[model samples]
Target: MTQITFKQGWRQLISGLADLRLAIILLLSIALFSISGTIIEQGQSVSFYQNNYPEDPAILGFLSWKVILTLGLDHVYTTWWFVTLLVVFGSSLTACSFTRQLPTLKSARRWQYYKRPSQFEKLALSTELSYLTLDQLIPELKQHRYKIFQEGNQLYARKGIMGRIGPIVVHISMLIILVGAIWGAFTGFMAQEMVATGETFQVKNIFEAGKLSKAQIPQDWQVRVNDFWIDYTQEGEIDQFYSDLSVVDLKGNELKQETIHVNQPLRYDGVTFYQTDWGIAAVTVQINNSPIFRLPMAKLNQEGEGNLWGTWVPIKPDLSQGVSLLTRDLKGTLLVYDTAGKLTGVVRPGMGIEVEGITLKVQKLIGSTGLQIKADPGIPIVYTGFGLLMVGVVMSYVSHSQIWALKVDNSLYLGGKTNRAQVGFEQEFLAILTALEKQQPQLVTSSSEKG
Candidate 1:
């Protein structure tokens, strides 16, 4: 007996470990850690921490290279502790659903037609009305949207009973989502590539900084950005930004073409790619020079000057001094100076300038373009989980109300109960009883009538 008791206690302990409350606490802890990871920028450079937090000892200590490496905070989501928390939470939810939810649902579905009026009287929200006959009360109960359960002198009626399953469904959905997320994190790879306009490049790795190795693209798949555009509001706020992309195979066969924007991504081959950002890049300009004409221009913009078109031209014959030519909105103007600290003339792009017997021309401009890339394999599962979660939440919150009616000799009794959403269920119950009394006046005794 003692051995059996020990075994039972152990089983109970194991069962308690898998409870819904434990799952909630585990989920909350994981959420807190995830929030912290986001707030503290994971996988950042050591210098970045040094610059951002020069004096804060806590940040300096925790964000050190050794600490990041030791604690796995550099990649918190994929870390062992984070994954363990998720797995534990998922197991708890699943256990709760199977162990607690199923039995509850079964009990809710069971027919309770033998409950006595004394049992109904014990309920907090029960209603007792003396009526003339069962015939009148039955119709009245049905009018209140209650399904009837009748046995002998007792009748049971229920409405919205399915609502009892909501919380269970919600828990199941959460489990599915967590499972999907875990599946994605372990099995999926993310890759990013920045391509300049009219240029194509293959993505080799995802930027995980120091933690994750570079990602690899499939040999059969290729991605190209056909174009990218950004529209800004009059107030300089971005209104819309999107990228036109084409997917192709190694044989150069086009597989698909799609436009992707923020919040709207493209999916193909079980992979989803998001359009995150775009930036300016690769600027170039051409200049023309001849023997009779000369132009000079700096590659970058001058100090304290806006990006204006300009060229430098040396004065004819002497050639020691030069004139600066400037253009605004295609209109040309000139400023003159010499090499000796004197003011130099501004010049427009494409204009020729002469200095020291040589002619110079403004040739070209160049700059960088930026692009943001992300690929997640688990989005489908996540979305499925979200759908399930919504359904479960709705089911859980809505009440399944049941009313019981019984008749013994000349007396009639009615009682109702709801699993949840009790306030609404009570209102419904009152309305049904009122309708029953109206239709069958004899069943509702004068003493039971409200003032």
Candidate 2:
């Protein structure tokens, strides 16, 4: 009795999980949360949320930094409730496949020949015909790609068995997709790096990462920015920026090298580096035959013009006086300013300007490349799942048709049915009957000749 009760409970659990309405509700809830994730900006800092979703004018009346952090809306895909939804949806698919699709496939695979003429009358399409035998009907069914089975005077045939397997494949594909999503959520990481020209560094500034993403981060490799440059259009506007990158090992041995631009990325060892931004890093300058010094440039945020970088160069050895040097592009031009915020002069690379009775020479401008790096281990699985899903959808459209026949006292009882495309299947059934009808006189004549 205990065993029976356990079995009943298990069966009921499976049945409840296999409910179509429940699956739809879970799917919709997942979509809703995903939309919220998109709208609320994932993986942003607390200060960013504090500024964007302030309490005084909370977005949607109740959305604020506190609410967002409490609900894990800052990273919805990795949230506990979101992941639970995915797991439950996957369980529902598995239960539906085992409890419904597999059983349906099993039933479709089991074919039987009807021994009684009365069996034909129970079909959706049934008719009584004269001058028909298994020998004449066999070729017609075979031409239509039916798999035939026989038992003395009764015959059975079926076609499109893939239609029965389609639902099962679809369920399996959906489960695979869910697994890929969960795996990516737990194993993938994203990071941004801004390296100056001729700089080599390891990935350390991780902005967003999963709990299990430590393995995905490169620990034994380093990336080198060999060079960074930009192309300008004829109108002096920026066109595109390029980064010459090299992948190296801990011993400084080069593993791979590539030149990447916007929409083109360098990929090595499962990690991809995408060129996303560019900036003026520094400028080289000399004062009155002094040794050349590299000055780091700082970016200034302006309202409407464009990007600008500036640096202050001290002229006096006492560190009491300095001149501000600013540039808007990497075209080697520098704008000099005095301590009183007055523009002194404009100079270019290899050109000189006298500042406080000393000649200041402007040299080359150094550029930096901003790269976004990511590693996703589940992409291949997701792609393969989608491929199987397409195949399953096409297979599901094919109608599974079955036909039965019994020879009884000089008359043939014929009937058939299909799971889909009812009108088309009826026409096909009539066409087969018409083809058998056309051969009747010829069969009789052949019989007479045989006699």
Candidate 3:
């Protein structure tokens, strides 16, 4: 009695797991959580959500900063609930593929040769040749490349088994993609650096990292910005910029080098370095008859603002009178303003202009490059899953067709069915029937000879 109850409960569990409706619900739930992951910025500081989603006027009328933090909206992909959702969805796909798709594929491959005339009559495309035998139909079906099975006078022909395997492949591919996403969530890191020209640095400024991301992060290598420069248009407008970068080992031996630009990145050992933004690092100026002095330029605007660097150049030993020099970029244009709030002159690098009767020479401008680097171990696996998905979709287009033949008494019955493309399959079955009818006498003579 206990064993019977256990069997009943196990069957119920499998039934629930293999339900189409349940699988669809799980898929939709996964998509909904994925959308939330996209909508809520992931891997952000507590202050970020606090500043954006305030308490008085919330983001969506009820979503406060505290709510976002408690719900793990700042890092949705790595959250326990989100990972559980993915694992559950993957389990549903696996269960459905095993209990549903695999059995259907096995049923399609099984050769169920028709024995009675009524069996053929039940098919969508069924007919009988009054004077035909199974021998005639076998050759024509074989010519059509249909896989045939025979037992005495009965025969079965089938083709396009790929249709049976397609859904299974698609389900497995989605599972693989889910695994890849979960793997990457626990083994990827993103970092950013604003290195000046000719500066070598290690990966230190990490904005985002996964739990097991140490293996993905670079520790034994360092990167150097050999040079950073911008390409300017003829109208002095900014064009694309580039950074000459080099990767070195722990002992400072160069291993690889590349010149990266906007939309182009350097990749080495699974780590990618993208040239994102640029700024002016420093300015060299010669005032009056004095020697050249290099001064650091500070960005006047915050993040996302236009690049504008400025510094003050003192003209006297007492530092009482000085000119404020402002430049947009490393294009060598500097605006000189007097201490009395008067526009003085526009000077370029290597050119000296009289500012309050004192010669102010702009010497050289140094450029800095902002690079965003990232490493994800599961990216290759994700790409492989996508490739398998495409192949599976193509396979799904093939129709799973089955043909049964039986020679009963004086009549030979032929009928076939397909899981998809029914109209086209009907036309093909009719052609096969017509061929059998036209060669009825020859088919009977051949069958008699074989028997």
Model 3 misplaced stretches (Cα beyond 4 Å):
1-10, 289-291, 302-305, 316-321, 440-451
Off by over 4 Å in 2: 303-305, 441-451
All candidates' TM-scores?
A: 0.74, 0.93, 0.92
In model 2, which range of ten residues has the least summed lDDT? 442-451
lDDT of 2 by residue, 24-106 (tens): 99999999999998898888899999999999899889998999999999999999999999999999999999888999999
Residue 302 lDDT in candidate 3 = 53
User: Which scores greater on TM-score, model 2 or model 3?
Assistant: 2
lDDT (0 to 1) per candidate: 0.63, 0.90, 0.85
Task: Score candidate 1 by lDDT.
Answer: 0.63
User: How would you order the candidates by TM-score, starting with the best?
Assistant: 2, 3, 1
For residue 101, model 2's alpha carbon misses the true position, in angstroms, by 0.6
The candidate 1 region of ten consecutive residues with least summed lDDT is 327-336
**Judged by lDDT relative to the true structure, which candidate is superior, 1 or 3?**
3
Better of 1 and 2 by TM-score: 2
Angstrom error of the Cα, residue 105, model 1: value is: 1.7
Write the residue-wise lDDT of candidate 1 on 1-451 in tens digits.
9999999997786598667678778978998888867876565667765566454564646555456556766567778899999988877776777777888888889866645657656554655556455666677666666777666777777777668788787887887888777766665565556555555555565654223222323557777777776667898566877778888887767799888888888777766677765543332222234343323333346576744444455545466665454442212233334555465444444554554344545432221124444444566788998999998877776777776667766556666666666677767767766766676675634323221
